[model samples]
Target: MQVLTINGQRRELDVDPDMPLLWAIRDVLELTGTKFGCGQALCGACTVMVDGMPARSCQTSVGDAAGKPIVTIEGVDGKVAQAVQAAWIKLDVPQCGYCQSGQIISAVGLLSQNRKPNDDEIDAAMSGNLCRCATYHRIRGAIHEAARMLEA
Candidate 1:
């Protein structure tokens, strides 16, 4: 049995250590907030926080994440995360809402370190995340808005 600290709770999962964290998160923990877009880590739909930094859970190993605190969309909520979520809502960035959780999670990670990320920086940070609804423009706007909200 392997132990993982997820969403502020500790749980034991009976699975392989090499199992992708996305599987452990969705199947073992039963927290479906984090999504499975591209299981190969091409998409950021499976993005989650590992010790407050954004990581691709689809490629991250459950053993590597052992004893580490994992925060999915359901676990995020500092001022930065809250501001990002609020900005996303204000901008209506999610037409499908399937990718919004990951988008928001990525935005939170970016905003936590950089108070003001320019277009290039935003692109660099958000490059891995894809939205089928093609809400890129609105996503950029929301990130900028969230930056301002964080500063305010």
Candidate 2:
């Protein structure tokens, strides 16, 4: 059995250690917020936080995630998360809304470390995440707005 802290809750899972964390999170735990975009980890749809750092759940092995605190979109909290969610809402960042959860997860991770990120930094931080709806402009704008909200 592999033990993990998910969304601030302790869980004991009986699954293959080599199984992808995305499956474990979505299938086992039934937390459907984290998505699977590309099984190869090329996309950020499965993005989650391990120890407050952005990690691609599709590529992250369940064994590798053991002992680390994992935070998914459903578990996002605190000021940074609130600010990001507010900014996303204000900017209407999502079109189809399929990638919004992962995007929001990445944004929360970015804002947690860097209160204010420049355009380059924002681009770099968000590079791995792709929006099929082509909401890049709104995503960038939301990040800046989230930063400003954090500052206030």
Candidate 3:
């Protein structure tokens, strides 16, 4: 049995240690918000906050994630997360919506550390996340809007 603190809940999962955290999160824990994009971690679709830093769940092992705080889109809350969610909705950032959860997780992670990020910074931070709809412009705008909301 492996104990994982996910989304503020202590879940004791009966699974292999080598299993990817994504599977543990999605298949075992039933939190389907975190996606499985590129299993190699090139795509940020599986992004989740592991100890407050954005980590690719596809590449992260359940063993590696043990004892660390994992935050998925389902449980992501706080000032920054709320602002990002609001900004995303207000800006209409989702296209197909497949990648929005991962995008939101990454955005919340970035904004948690940096209250204000410029275009270049936003792009750099969000570069790993791929939006097939090519909604990069709207994503950036939402991040900026989220930042603005944070300031107010």
TM-scores of all predicted structures: 0.96, 0.99, 0.98
**What's the number of clashes in each of the models?**
0, 0, 0
State the lDDT of candidate 2 residue by residue for 1-152, as single tens digits.
99999999999999999999999999999999999898887779999999889999999999999999999999999999999999999998999998888899999999998999999999999999999999999999999999999989
Please give the TM-score that candidate 1 achieves against the real structure.
0.96
Off by over 4 Å in 2: none
All models: lDDT? 0.92, 0.94, 0.94
Over 25-122, each residue of candidate 3 has an lDDT whose tens digit, in order, gives 99998899898987999889999999999999999999999999999999999999999999999999998999999899999988998999999999
C-alpha lDDT (0 to 100) for residue 121 of candidate 2? 94
> How close is each model in CA RMSD to the real structure?
0.9, 0.5, 0.6
Better of 1 and 2 by TM-score: 2
Native-to-model Cα distance after best TM-score fit, residue 49 in candidate 3, in Å: 0.6
Please write out the lDDT profile of model 1 over residues 34-131, one tens digit for every residue.
99998888889999999878999999999999999989988898899889989988988889899888999999999999999999999999999999
> Model 2, poorest ten-residue lDDT window?
34-43
CA displacement after TM-score superposition, residue 68 of candidate 1 (Å): 1.4
